[model samples]
Target chain A: MDISFTSLLWGFLLIIIPTYFLHHYRTGLVKDTLIAALRMTAQLFLIGFYLKYMFDLNLWWLNVLWVIIMAGVASQTIIKRTNLSLRQMFVPITIALICSVAIIDIYFMGLIVRQDNLFETRYFIPISGMILGNMLSANVIAMNTYYGVLRRERTNYLFRLANGASAHEARSPFMRDALIKSFNPTIASMAVMGLIALPGTMTGQILGGSDPDVAIKYQIMLMISIFASSLISVLLTLALTHHKIFNKYEMPI
Target chain B: MIQFNNTYFIYDEKPLISGFSVNIARGEKVVIYGPSGSGKSTLVHAILGFVQAEQGEIIVNNLPISPDSINEIRQLTSWLPQDISLPYNSVRDMILAPFEFKANHSRKPSDQEILAEFDKLKLEHNLLEKGITEISGGQKQRILLLTTVLLRKPILLLDEPTSALDAQSVDLVINYLKSLTDTTIIAISHDEKFINAFDRKLLIGQF
Candidate 1:
């Protein structure tokens, strides 16, 4: 809300790319700088448009539907990033996101704050969008680690498979890696909260005239939701990706 | 027992080994000797299901193997790969890797068994505490051998298990491998000394 639409849009377009290469981070510097600026603008503009219309309508079914769509798109990105098969990824990941997101949302809306309408536009839309965004990021990290570790330790995984380990056993190392990688940032962020940095959500709350204590409470709830969502999503992705990547014989290359 | 029927392997659509057919019965210690680029490593890798073959059938223990069944075949076979990269946890973890699988999970050998194998390779008891990154190439090869042996697979596929060893180390490895002849040992190497008293030789040519 604090970020104006024109500033956000034009500012991104006006992004100046550094032409000369720096010492260490010079790999694709100009292209990356330009592309990143463009991508950020386009992505944020698209989200802004979508959010405007979505909030205007404010229907519960539409909100729920959007969340599902966001989840699907996020899953697709995850699949593409990891180069994993998509045959059976839909069910496990969707189920994980729904369960984890709903748990925290229900507690925040129903029990703690007890908002007037459980499906109100003001509360449901922003929180849900935030949850979806967090979920997407967490899953990317998780799925990335899972796929990377599996590839790097291919021999070890094959060795496990040969030793009569099931598909789960073969993928245990990757699963552990995925879960750890996915959850690490959130854990670190929480650990350093209010000391090293103030999170965006809490800052936004303070700017909106909310008390610091209230903002802190909201931030706490969000951390829990992000953590929970990340954990469940990572676990689900790891388990399902194992099945999708491996054949009936547990071969992963 | 293993059978390679007209196996043809290609990488980037370029044939490495073509029309290569061979067979090995149980407890037969056969050596595959070839020039550097003759696809000897490729053939060994193919049998392990690591390298995909363009055309041909490979049957191990009477089961036809595709790229997928590499895991199944690997369970029943021990491997000392030509590239001896043991980049995992500690040296102990590297050595005990075979026992961590379902096929050999129940057979996590006692300390005495591990110590015996280590002693046989003239390794020290303290080597178990060291990390894989800290081990020498020869030591890593010995760990790989012990790890592969712990699998107790019927077929043992070795790729230059002694190519880098000193004469004494080579002698030790060869004798230990010789004693484990209950396995169908098909070793790929160009070392004339190792193959001097070998049971049989399959000389490979440029593909």
Candidate 2:
């Protein structure tokens, strides 16, 4: 099923269509898009080779170490994308992602898949990557929304606090707003999932020669794990980082 | 009772309030008058620990305003900020919102008590059920004032409470506030009538 270099070069030719449209429309994104596509190709090729070697070795500790590295990169990406203070957010976000990914990995591989080795390369790496990828976007949306709402609605928060609300009570509204905003898109996509769009995991599995029934089951479980992990990680990140963002009087510093 | 003893506040690396001192007795109704940018509101905010004094001490009800005592100080105070944003959909929800907090749960007002305040504030009975967006600014101001009143806290801080009200509504509000003999009322206002209605007037930033 391996595509030769000649076939991949032909695939790269498709970029001309986007480049032409971007240039003709005066969008000024042609250079940036070209650079981005090149970077993507290079990065994926490197990862493809690396993953091949790691999978061949199939060492459990190596698999765990790779997942930990993924969690760290995901945490850093979330912080950078959300425009939060990395020094304040990095450890909390990293710990939250690690904890959530570990929980889902244990539950999925141990109980559900009934695999003897929970850290098997095939089960551990891809499952952890999928869950972490989903969590990265969810945490970005949640942290962005939470901090944005808190800043925009400072008066509302102060009003509640001045009128005898505890810090938790005053902050609950912002938390509620963040949760709703972050989850709405995910929930909507879940609702229309197989009907309008074939999800990536399901499509990949089907193309990879997995049975349709098995692929759908895996997709279902992956979606559930993603939802759970994202929720747990977002709550944990907020809980851990709350003191860093607010002062002793529960005011945003 | 509240006391600001030789307090100083710095904003934007400048002294907005320096060496300012004031003592408000229990059950006193005091109005603070000053020109714009005189830090009048900041003075009241210091009581609730929203603005920390760079120097000196602030005492509220015998407890110093500090990180440790701010919650207790706020629990005893009800504040109406100058600019209002209604997070609730209806007036009734806004009125009951503060009471829903655990700190204020014990003092939750009854329906009759709320209706009584609505009557006194000259707000219509139907307005309670109306959407917050449907109410006029004056009505919104009165509704917020009513909420603070209903809290029955020992200290009340009103920042520009009558800015949106008409002369008649202002009179009604002043009269209602005058009736609360046990509350320490510290109001910031430029309205001559509002200043006259209070028991004492302190001109801030004259120096």
Q: Which candidate is the best by TM-score?
A: 2
DockQ for the candidates, in order: 0.27, 0.85
Supply fnat for every model shown. Answer: 0.28, 0.87
Where does candidate 2 stray beyond 4 Å? A18-32
lDDT computed for candidate 2 = 0.91
Candidate 1, position B21, lDDT: 91
Candidate 1 positional error at A96, Å: 7.2
* Per-residue lDDT value at A185 in model 2: 83
Best by lDDT: 2
Local accuracy of candidate 2 as per-residue lDDT tens digits, A1-253: 6678999999999999999999999999999999999999998889779989988999999998998899999999999998888998889889889998999899999988989999988889989999999998888899999999889888888999999989999899989988998888888988999999899999988888889999999998988888888899889889988988998878898
- Cα lDDT tens digits, model 2, B113-144, are 89899999878889988998999999999999
lDDT of 1 by residue, A1-253 (tens): 4668777666655444344433246575777677776797688779779878877888888877777777777777766666666656766776667666677678778976798667766777778778877887888887777777777777666555544565666677677777777787888889999999999999988998899999999898888877776676666666655556665545663
The true-structure Cα RMSD of candidate 2 reads 1.9
